[model samples]
Structure formats: structure tokens, C-alpha cells
Target: MRDAPLEFVTAMAAHGDVTRHDADGEPVYMLHRPDLARHVLKENGAAYTKDRTPDDDMLRPLLGNGLLTSNGAEWAAQRRMCAPAFRPAEVDRFDRVIVEAAEHLVAHWDGGRPVRVDHDLTSLTLTVIVKAMLGTDIGVAGEGFGRAVDAVNRFIGHYVPSDDPDPADTAARYAGFHRARTFLDRVTRVIIAARRAGGAGDDLLGAMLAEGHTMSDADLRDQVLTIIMAGHETTAKSLTWTLYLLDRNPEAARAVHAEIDEVLEGRSPTAADLPRLRRCRQAVQEAMRLYPPVWLISRRGTADDVLDGYDVPAGSLVCVSPWVLHRDPRYWAEPDAYRPERFDPDRAARLLSHQYLPFGGGPRICVGRHFALVEATLVLAVILRGLRMELVAGFPVEPEALVTLRPRHGLMMIPRPR
Candidate 1:
């Protein structure tokens, strides 16, 4: 499972829509059917809890009881408090940051040489999230900030579900994780302290630390770290995969290029322009369908429950995988193909709830769903308008099923002006 986790889970789809196996005495159920996914993630979601589950166990060390790992009333309160910051008005405010950052990265690209799209996008999205969320320039935190995040991701990539206790952490990996955690903790503390001293903030951080808010410094740290990490990492992976997919499919790439040319002419994209960037947006959507950033969603049953006629014992671990569901031949036509048109507005509208959950579903759906789509679409537009990335030949790109689905060795591409 550790050597090839994605492959191991994907192989189960061959058996049936629902598969069960034992891991250290616990029954692990993998749901491949959308209806079943809905049962676990939505309709009967109350029966499952993220708290203390495999996902929370792995992420709690880093995220604490942030919205992603919290449960019940605690999760509800956090979600409500954070909702105002992600409203339409607030997300629109982030467009300029996304485009400007993408444009900045484009300016640095060497058109003639191979560029690491994954690495550059990671840095770009990190910068955007920091500036947009906390109103601070990540640059001030130095290069180690990005390195620390990378180290954390590397350590997390080693995670595998087991009923037994986690194996002893490797010395080098644990050291890297510690440094990353410490650096992020210190940075968030400084930002929060400065903001508190400066009085009210108009950004996400300020709102969370506003007057009368019950969030202590530690609580703020968890929420801030969760946003900074969740906000940037997934979007970066989505863009990287979008570019890689477009590069692999010439017809799709041309469609995106033509759409961008017609829509923007020579100007940069804004939030208003998002509605018309159809093909570019669809490309991003399809890429996520093929390689969802959050490939696995883990929860444990809080009580005995029945799903799809199967008796789910209390304490059973249930997993809903977008990776497996997205490619189900039962729902998607030519499931393995890079066909962005699959996400054409009308066609996409026909998709059932869990059939295409790049951002998940139900009450606990990703709070930043709109923000992520807007950011990815606009960033893709900004890039396609000024440059085209050509995937290096035989680069051997493979998806590493870590905390996010990432190109295992980084995507090497040549940036050519469009």
C-alpha cells in the first residue's frame, strides 16, 4: 500500500462499486458509486465523523482542530465564522492577486529552457494565498517558507492507512516535518501579532482575529495554517495538472488558446471575465476530474449504519475517493481520456452530486470551492494568453498520491510565448 497507494485503491474498482477489506482488525470500505458516496459524505454524513479518523490523525498534527478535522458543533461554528471571508464579494477581491502572481511567474520563465511548472506554480500559489489571506508578502518570510511547506508535503506523502499504530517516524523526515511546523507556527504568530497590534484587519486574518471573536492565538494559528496550506496547495496542483493535460492534448490546448484569444484579446482576466472563459475553466475542471488534488476523503462511522444494504459496524473506516469515482466507466464516457468538453456547461450540469466532486459535496464541502475554481480558471487564462507550456518529452510524469495528487518528479516544460 505504501509503495503504490493509488494503484492499490484503483485496482479495487475492478471488483465492484463497493469493496471491503480488513486493515489491522478494522473494516475499511471503499465507495466507488456516487450514490454510495452521497450516503457516506452527504445524506447520512452525520453517521460518519472526520474527528480522530485516518485523515484527522494524519492532518491533526499539522492542522489541529481546524475545519478540515473538526466535527459537529465545533466544525459548524468554524465554518460559519469563516464563511463571510469566502463570500462572492470576498473571492472577487482575490482575482487581482491570482492574475498578478501568475503574470509575475510568466515574466520569470525562460522561453527556451525547460521549466518546472509544478515548482513555479507551487511558489506562485503560495504567494497568492499569503498575500490574499493575511495581506502579507510571503517573500518576507524568505525561501525557507516554501521549502518548509515542501518538506511537510514530502513527509505527508509517506502516509498509508493502517489499523496498527503509525510506524516510528524516520529521523530525517521527522526533523524536516518539525522544522516545517515550527517555521509555519512562528510565521503565523508574527502575522497575527502584527495584525492585532495594528488594529482591525480587512483581510481574512483580520476578520478571524476581529474584536469579540473567541479564537485564541492558538486557534487562529490552526485556522490560518489550514487556509494557507489548503488555499494554495490544491490550487497549485490543479493548475499544474491542467497545463500538463492541455500540453498532452493538442486539440484541447488549441481550444483553450482560441478561447483565451477571443475573450481577453491582449488584456488580463478579471473576475467578470470568468463566465466567458468556458473552455479554459472546463479544462481545469476536467483535469481535476482526472487527478483530484484531494484524492481521498476519510471518515469513520460514529455508530452502526447500513449503506447500500451492507451493515457498517461502528468504528469502521469509510473512504470516498474522487480518484476512483471520477473515472468510473459507469458514469464518464471514455473515462481515461483527456476530454475537457466532458465539462461543457450543459453536460456538467447533468452530472450527479458525487459523480464529479473535485471540490467534494454536502454541508462540509470545501469552503473555498468558489475561490479555488475562480483562481484556477483565471490563472489558466492569464498563462494561456501570454505563454504556452510544452511538456518535456518522456518526462515520466506520475501522480504521487500524497496529501494531494502531485506530479511525482515535477513537470518539466518549455514556456513559449503564445
Candidate 2:
């Protein structure tokens, strides 16, 4: 359990559907079965709560009481208030912002050079999320926000056990996190202030302000950071992996491009165009199946109960890793292969609700799920129109399980003119 933090997801596969680990003296259950995963995350959700372990404590300071970390009435309130902004209808209205950000990324790309696809997409998604959610540009932010996120995640990646970390090392990590949070805090405060001064508009932040929703200074900062970082990192990594997979399979790439050409017709796409881009959506779905950004989720059992007829003791931590479940032979045929057609409308509709959880399930499902799909689909359509990205030969794609599933050293790829 302690030795292979990066391989935790894959290592669990060597065990059967359910395996138990001794955390201190207590037993923690890692359930790979989709049915039990659904039971824990959705069906009998009340029987469990977010595991309030030290790992989560590490994020509380950075995230505060935002929706991602908060529980009970607090989480409910924040989720309800923000839900309006992330709904499909609302996300559709932000099409212009999404396209504009994609355009901005193209302008900055060093054409025909080997670009760090992961870092580039991080910048692109960060820009899109900021503009859509806050109605602001990240101009000259110089990829600082993404760097800050990486710094904190790298610190957290030291998921290794310690009787106590070296005092100096602890201090360094805390200091580093402080610097990153300070930057995000400053950015969030500016957004809040700008919204206040300018009256109000339809941006998510402005809409909240317009509705007279209020929070303490700290809570607002947390919400701002949560909205931006959560939306930014997941969508970026999904795009990076999608491109990586497409590069490895030219047939699929050609199909994706043909669909893009047919549906978009050499014009910039809109929210209306998204519904007709079936192949584009299928590719994104299959990509998510292969490398879901939020790869692992866990909840501590609140009561002694039976899940799928197995005893789940009260207070035991139960993990549901989508990484394993998506690859489970039980739910998928040729799970490891990149087969976008597996998600064609008829087949996708036939999949069991519990089996496909790229965005998670049940009440506390990701708030930005709709926004992410819309954003990812649009980014792929626009980017493929002008460039064909290929992985540099021999570039290692190491899957690092951080706050999101990231390619450890960043995905290096070359963008050739289409």
C-alpha cells in the first residue's frame, strides 16, 4: 500500500475485484466492482462519507470549504448555488469564450516544434475556464496557475507514509503551498472585486454576485480556486490523453478529422454543432475510459452494512477507482484498446449506468461534468482543424496519479500543419 503510490491503481488490479489493506490497524477496502462502486458512491451513498483522512487534510487548506472538500449542509449549499452555472444550457452560452481561448492557444503555439501537449492544454483549458466562469482573461498569467497547481500536487504526491516528515521538508512543502495559494488567492480576490465594481453580468461569478449570494472572504476564495482549478486540470489532461491516443491510431485520427470536417465544414463550431459531432464525442468518451482525469474516489463507511452482500464495517475506507473499473473485462470488451466506436450512441446507451463513471455518479457527481464535455469536444474540434498532433518517438507516457491523472513529465508531441 505504501511502496507504489504511482502504481496504486494498476497494482490493485493484481488483486481480485475487492482487496483489503491494513491502514495502521484498521482495514481499508478497495472495491473494483462497478456495482459496489455504485452502491458506495450513489445507491447507498448515505452510508458513506468522504474519507476524512490525512490525505484530505492536505487539500483542505488549499481548497478551504469549497464544494469539492466540504460535506453535509455546507457542500449542499455550495453545490446548489453553483449548479445553475454549470448546467448544459448555461455552458452552451459560453461557446464564444471556449472558442476564443482555443484561438488564443493557437496564436501562442510555436508552430512545427515539439510542444509539451500536457502543459499547452493546461494553459488552454485554464484560459477557457477562467474566461467562461469569471469572464476574465488569463493574459500574461504566464502559466503560473498551472505551475502552482503542479507544485502543490507534487507535494501531495509524496503519499508515502512518514512517522513524521523531516521538519525542514515539511516547512518547505508548507512554504511552497503557501506561495501557490497566495497567487491563486490574489487572482480570486481580483475577480471578486471586479465583479463587485462592475455591477454584474452573466459569468458564473457575476451571476452569483447578481443573485446576492454571499460568502465569507475565505469561502469565496475557495470557491473561485475550486471552480477554476477543478475545471482546468481535468479537461486539460483529458485533451492531452485524447491526442496521445489518437496519435497512436492513425485510422481513428483520420476518422475524428473526417467527422470534424464534415460537421464543422471549415467554420468555427458552436454549441449547436456539438450534438452533430458524434465521432468527436465518442472519441472523448473512449479517451476518458482509458484515462479518466479523476481516476480514484474513496468514501469512508458511516455504518456497518452489506454492499453487494459483502460486509463493509463502519469507519472502513472504501475506494472506487474508475481507472480499474473502466478497464475491467467484465464491463468492457477489449478494454485496453482505443476503440471510440464502443461509445457510438446505440452502444453507449446500452451500457449500465454504474459501469461508465468517467465523471463519477450519484448525488455528489462532479459539478463541472457537463462543462468539461462541452469544453473538451470544442477544443478537439478547433485544434484538429489546423494541426495534427503526434507524439515524439520514444517519449515516455508515464501515468502519474496526482490530484488528477497526469502524464508524469508532461506529454511531448509535435503539432504538424494539417
Candidate 3:
């Protein structure tokens, strides 16, 4: 388990690209080869589905059969129906909302004081997505609501079904998942019904209704919960990592601010301005490369599959660590360094296909990838340009692979006025 980050990386490096081992009797293939990754994620994708039982077991209770966890026909159909909601123009509509959320964070900050970045960015991303993706304002709404979701994410992230636990304790966590999920379900249902009746339908819920494709309440719950949780969580962690990286590397922060100065000239960045904010984009990309928000992408081989002479039996578990691949010493120099320039023009050009799995690969790649990039770009533009975030000295910020590659102890920093 990469939950033990050091052991996981050392193991991956030991085998170079592909390694197969028995895990409590069943075969587990840890693949690092780029072409092989394409085989599993792109070319021979049908042989696999995102149904690795161990992780999805915890997710099923929260996500239902949403796009993130569904397989086969259900997955394909839902992908089509939800495509329009994330189309360029639809996501473009949320530009102002992203900026507003970024600015709102800056406004609340007192400057030069230690800030709990994980909490702040989570609140900002949650608030933005709830408004922009769902057409509802859950602005800094409930500290408890955010805290509850964190508890569920923690339980799911570190949970290993194989490890037997006390039945009483397991039941309590299950109860917690339902408690948080029920609240989210109510919120999603409200948006769904309102949109159906021609009410507050400005986000994806609106777009779905406008298309006349109705989903049963159960399906709707799954979709909304999937979008809200999956949609906001990854981007939030990515943003947190980006800021933390920039804060510690003043040179990278200078380059980021320089790009903002040259491009936006002291104004909030818009979609059109994104292309020119090269350094900002690189900083974010590099951060994701170093600490991908969703650290592990796993699937189950539905049919016997072979890659590079290695046989992967049907029902076997396959895993790809963007965290591992991005840092593979074979491909990346100084695999552990935080240098945003690694993503710059000359360097990015030399990168290979599956060498970067920040958003995963191929057809089943995250549908929200574009929207996430846009939101992250805009938020980075606003904050990285105007603020200087310094990590609280002596605070150890390390990756704790959970539902996301969250900072082990929430990223603590001081966001001083630039």
C-alpha cells in the first residue's frame, strides 16, 4: 500500500517498470512502464474497469454508482449525459465565480499569520464548486459540514478492507459515512428538484435538466455526490499543494508572480489570460506532478491481459501511481525536487505519453479535467499574484495518501500581502 509512501516508492523502483507480486494470495501488478500504462488506460482499456474492490468498497457507500466508480454500460451512458455539463462554454460560465472564491479567501486573511491552508482551500474550492458546478451558494457554510466530509475521506483513504477490525468500530464509521452522505444527498436533491421545476438551475444540474435527460433520484444522488466530492476535493488539494510549493520556493514564487505581472498587469485573471500565465500553470502542474491530489489510480482486470510479456490474470488488481510514475528516476531527474521549471516548454516537450498521469490517461480520464485546470489556473492567478504564503517554520508538511495526497498535517502557512 502506498499509504506507506517510502516503502511503496522503494518497491516500485526495485522493479524498474513492472512488478507482480502476491498480496495475501492474489496477484497484484504495480506497473510503471509508460506504454504499458497506455495499454491499461487507453489501448486495451476494455480489459479493465475502476472496480478494484478494496478501495471502491469504501467509495461505493458514498459515491453510489456514479461516473467515478461505475463500469460498462452505466459508465458509458452517464459519461455521455454529463459531457455537456462540462463542455468548454458551460465551464467558462464559472470563471467569475472562481475568482470570487479566490478573492473571498484573501479578504478573510489577516496577513503574515499562520493559515491552515488545507482548511482554507477546501472551503474555497467547496464553496466555488457548489456555486459554479451546482448553482448553489454554500459559502463558508458549515465548518462542521466540511469537518464531517474530512472524517469520511480520512476513513476511506487509510482503510484497508483486508485488515479485520472490531465490528463495533467499523459500524460507527459506516454510520458516519451515511450521516455525511445524507446531508449531501439532501442538498443535491434540492438542486435536482428545483431544476426539474424550472428553478435555480445554473450549474450542471441545470444543464442536465435543459437537455431533458432525467435521472432517478437515486442516480441523481450518485451523480451529484460524485461531482461535488470528486469535483472539489482533488482541485482543493492540488491548490493547497501549489501554494505550499510556491511559498517555500521563492524563486518559483517570483517566476509565478512575474508571469501574473506580465500577463494580467494587476487584474484578476480570466480564461483568455490563462494561456499567457505560463509560469503559473507550470507551478501548478509541477505541484501536481510532485504530489498528485489523487495519488493512486487502480482498476481490476476483467479478462486475462498481458503487457510486455507479463500476464495479468482476470480479476487481478492493477495499480498506477501518478505519484510513483511522475517521480520515476528513470524518467525524471531529481525526482524529489520541487522545481516548476520541469514543466516549462523545453522540458515539457521531452515528456512521454503516460509519463504524466496527473489527470490519469485515455478515454476514462477525468471528465472534469478541463474545468479543474481552469479553476486552478484562475485561483492561482488571483492568489499567487497578490499574496506571499510562507509555511509555518518547524511544521512538517508531508503527504498522507488518503482519498487525496493530502498534507499529513494540514498545510499551515502565512498568507501575507505581497
Cα RMSDs, all models: 2.1, 1.9, 2.2
Alpha-carbon lDDT of model 2: 0.82
lDDT (0-100) at residue 348 of candidate 3? 93
Residue-level lDDT of model 2, residues 1-418, one tens digit each, is: 4455537756876787778777777887888787788888888998887748543655676887787888878888889889989989999998988887787676666478888888888888988888888877777774788888888787765554566557787778878978988887887788788778887777778766765546766777788888988889889989999999999989999999999889878999899999887788788889999998877787887899786567878988888888888888888999899999998888888888768888888998999999999999998898897889888999999887776788988998888888
TM-score of each: 0.96, 0.95, 0.93
> By TM-score, how accurate is candidate 3?
0.93
Identify the candidate with maximal lDDT. Answer: 1
| Per-residue alpha-carbon lDDT of candidate 1 for residues 210-320, written as tens digits (9 for 90 to 100) | 733688778988988899889988999999999999998999999999999999999999999988999988999999999999888888999998877888899889998
The window of 10 residues in a row where model 1 has the poorest summed lDDT is: 160-169
Ranking, lDDT, top scorer first:
1, 2, 3
List where candidate 1 sits over 4 angstroms from the true fold.
Answer: 160-169, 211-213
* Whole-model lDDT per candidate: 0.86, 0.82, 0.80
Ranking by TM-score: 1, 2, 3
